[model samples]
Target: MYFERAHISDGELLAFYKALLYPRLVEEKMLLLLRQGKVSKWFSGIGQEAIAVGATLALDNDEWILPLHRNLGVFTARQMPLQQLFHQWQGSPLGFSKGRERSFHFGSRQHHICGMISHLGPQLSIADGISLAHKLKKEDKVSLAFTGEGGTSEGEFHEALNVAAVWDLPVIFLIENNGYGLSTPVEEQYRCEQLVQRAAGYGMRGMRINGNNLLEVYHAIKEAKRHALHEQQPVLIEAMTFRMRGHEEASGTKYVPPALLEEWARQDPIQHFEGFLQFLQLINEEGIHDIREALKHEIDREINTALAEVSPPVSEADELKDIYAPAPSPIPPVAGAATHDKRFIDAISEGLDQAMVQYPNLILMGQDIAEYGGAFKITDGFVARYGKERVRNTPLCESAIVGAGLGLSLMGYKSMVEMQFADFVTCGFNQIVNNLAKIHYRWGQTADVVVRLPAGAGVGAGPFHSQSNEAWFTHVPGLKIVYPATPADAKGLLLAAFADPNPVLYFEHKALYRSISGPVPEAPYTIEIGKANLIQTGDDISIITYGAGVHWALEYSKQHPQLSIHILDLRTLLPLDYEAIREAVTATGKVLILHEDTLTGGLGGEISAWIAEHCFALLDAPVMRCAGLDTPVPFAASLEKNFLAKTRMHQYIEQLANY
Candidate 1:
């Protein structure tokens, strides 16, 4: 049996069949544009039209839809203007993000389609987040996130399902198994025979549907949405569809077997649905032809409108804008808050407590955040203090943890989520890099999330646990990377992050948690996020550093009394303190950079290059960099010391001495 002959009504068949045809032909037009060289790339939802259009028809106009790059049918059936899609293909700025996003990668905050995430599995977690927000906000809206079979391999996919299941969030996770992920088949992608089987691990109901059958897809989505909204439990729908085209426009069907293609072709969602419509007798042959032509004309008109829209021109200002939303209420005067007589960890603990109070919507969610108090006990006592509702102790799913944070933030809550270790943040890379960082830029500030990581390499925590990956987050736009050197800065930065409209990556140095104690304010306060602190003022050399580097620089400065050093601690890395850096390097005439991250593509190179470009005339010597050797931080305390920047800081001072 090529397709399932379910109890689908004639009227339903007609509606679904027409849906399949209209979108298929519209997608074909896009293919023509691609062959004509009018579009750069084309990813048509050819054979898999039913899953896209059918699921959407069952969904409310207001329900959130997170489509993958291949769900072109969703856009076509949902009446997304064609000209805009064409403009996106044409690489026109006007088309790229008229409001939400370009063609295949799109979402509408107003329409409740939370933007599309180009990176696959992240959207699944984000869908959970959006669903969580709807529950918290008491909105009736449900979130639907789609991904391919290959996306299930990502940690984010599992994380999302588990979290949604645990919290009973209103999210529908649709797995579109199109047989191949790029060139890799579903069999090669996973050890599990059926992708839906994994849902049981999360204690969620899972269903598999004939993806080419519009009726099956529609009913599955409807049932999934019902479970999400009424039961408040997440549902996973595995739609076994086929990819008629290659992965992308440039790709060919050479890798796929002709027999399988022909077999799936008979189950062609569009053609099958068209035949179903004829069987139902809803419309004659002429009526179907008229509707098809009407859709083409409508799509063409939309495309033209998209072409006429305007986009911001490429300029240096585009780089600066949207990094940080106007700080919530301008920075108050530096009126000193009362100092709290507490230990470093105590200060952080109290600060987090006070932060939750100040911002009632703020939540503390992470693995063991409620009961175990996090791996490092940073979130210890939080669950008991905030209750299970706000202080959520998540399963050990890093991708879901971050994805849930992103979703919680979207619901108007300031979600402070923690990764047990900085090294583990890599597991949630799809959520962090693609979903959290780009959400604001793509969907226009729909998600305001804060991700806190216990980072750096001083802890003899071994290779997997000890890593400084701040440089990775810093590279992504729309993310604010903060590495607080002091417990006071940690408290202040975390507070500021809660107030931020954009996403913030607050990296706390693990070694500095208890080792470094400082005067923490008893009163609520937030330091300027992007501003760098000029700790020690001297004229000979400028030491540009951050995180643990700030502490190391101070140590080096103390050891070298004769040498005059100007230490600039970049509190924020993404929107660097370029103005302060330019002034300091100009005044000092010599520059020395330091960091604990790997030397390759580290922040040191960027600062050093900037000085060479802007402070060339002020320089008495070339800008020097001191960073960890390009190797994994060794486990032994002594070996780790030699492999990290703290050990090499003195050597840098010696280099600055000769210069």
Candidate 2:
């Protein structure tokens, strides 16, 4: 039937109607499941389905969609099987997450969909990276990112939009303004009248549309896609809509006024669109009823089948698998150890150069890394050697940089992100702790990104620049933490981090960057991530340490040559080599755990506790711990020396030796 009243073709209109009906039907079934205590929770995009469906339909099938938790319509448009969707909600083995993640926290690379994180805004920056990959590959594709009006309030939202604008990336930032951010009204969320208005500040074109109107959303997104693909520009589209239901099934809309709810019910997107279809002679009342009944029946059959399937068994061993990407095959160590000395910084730069040469997909990104060679000249001449595309100089946006690296990793590129200083990693902690660390465990995803942290407290860079924050990441599971003390270890561990199939936080000591020099193999070598280096073997006491503490221990042992102290340099903190630690303790019968981070919650406590529990009999005295004072690193050299336990190590070593 040709509908003269509707601008869209009959086929297009029908597809749009079915897309809308599918999610609505599934949402109704989900609610029924919730009532029957079959499903845990659900975030419904009831009135906002048009925005999800229309915006997704506007994109080409080859383009990527970074969906939000409520974007069920996007999954439907992407041809996600109804059975899989039901299985996911039912926590069955057939789901994408294998019952590991809840709700829409799963995504399929095969489907070109980046899964949603609980922290919704970080995906925007990741989408920017995906768009960047598309641009680099010279592919005529755009990445569509979906988020709610509430997500715009997050700093990541601004960071992502700014990066996208600055780079002219092909990304469409679609915002579903559902009037409330989990019961908090739009009036309280932001001062701007329209959410799209904020895009102008980021140098992007912005538009506002009626999200409930399918045609308006579809056309707006089509224009946005055109701008992104052709002009390499990002566009922000704010779809003004309402949350017809509560935030989730459990969170009822008691906060919503009855009058407002009643008003929205009258302007329901489905009913309004159905009326338009009727007016266009495309569908009558009987046909609409039949379509609804068919959709309901299909949804019921899928849900029943999903419920009947057996869920995957969860075991401790299964949980432990894939925590770290399988380690790459070991490269045979070069014959003979006598080699020319290379500075720590030189070793690191060489390692990066070698890794990039080995893997064409390896990309380096950070502030001032390209022309300026980074803050410490670690990446000096990298851009000139590798070109600007592979060695990117990004703005001073830590979270976005990390998130972009995550996106690049998802796109089959191994990215190394340089945090100008370790302390500044706090800015990107959300991406590190939540997204990068949890993605693998949640959905068996791999984020092969290495975050280079120039950490420690010796150069008198003060509190902001000098920090040994390895403990922070060591506490997080699914992350490989490596702190290399010497130039050789630095090069080897960095290469290993790039080679590993997991997210790695490589802590490079800032003070030792130039001061430390040692014979590093010119050939590329990888020091296993979980292994420790026995710097010196003695019989009196064992000093268990890492990073700059190795230097301190060496100096202390040199000063007190009478004390037979064995020093074990723990190169990898997370997957600690407890065997080496036990060997040292058994050989010496005394233990001293040391680190540069603060004493209270430093890695020393964990090591000490482990030794106390397992190797308590081997210890002659208490497992002594000497770490930095529990205070911010001071500025003055004298005070900084006192803040760190460097000066006190010798005193403790003497006391332990005498005892």
How does each model score on TM-score?
0.90, 0.97
| Model 2 ranges off by over 4 Å | 1-8
User: Please, what are the lDDT tens digits per residue for candidate 2 over residues 1-659?
Assistant: 11132367888887889988789888988888898989888998887788888888878877788988778998998888889888888777678887777889888887788898888899999998888888788888888888898999999999999999988998999998888889899888999888888988988889998888877788888888888788889999998888978898778899999998888777677887888888878999999999999998988888788778777676788778856557687564588845669999899988999999998988899999999999999888888888998999898899998999888877788899999999999999999998899888777779999999998888999999998889988889999999999988989999999989899999999999899999998888888989999999999989999999999889988987887879999999989999999998998888899898999999999999999999998889888999999999999999999998897787787778778
Each candidate: RMSD: 3.3, 2.0
Error of 1 at 276 (Å): 3.7
Candidate 1 similarity to native, TM-score? 0.90
Q: On residues 1-659, what C-alpha lDDT tens digit does candidate 1 reach at each position? A: 24444776666666666667777777777787677776777776788888988889889877778888777767766766566556666766555453335456756555555556666777787777778778877887788888899888876776678788888887888989999999898889998879889888888889998988887888788888887778888888899988988888678889999999998888776666666566657777898889888878876777667656776777556545644456675243256657755655666677688888887788777877788887778778777677787888778788777877776766666787788888888877777787777766664654567787888888798788889988887778778888888877877777787777777888888888878888787777787788888888997788888888888888877887988889888989977889999988877777888899998999888888888888789888888888998999889999899889777776667767687
Q: Which candidate number has the best lDDT? A: 2
Considering every candidate listed, which one attains the maximal TM-score? 2
Native-referenced Cα lDDT, model 1? 0.78
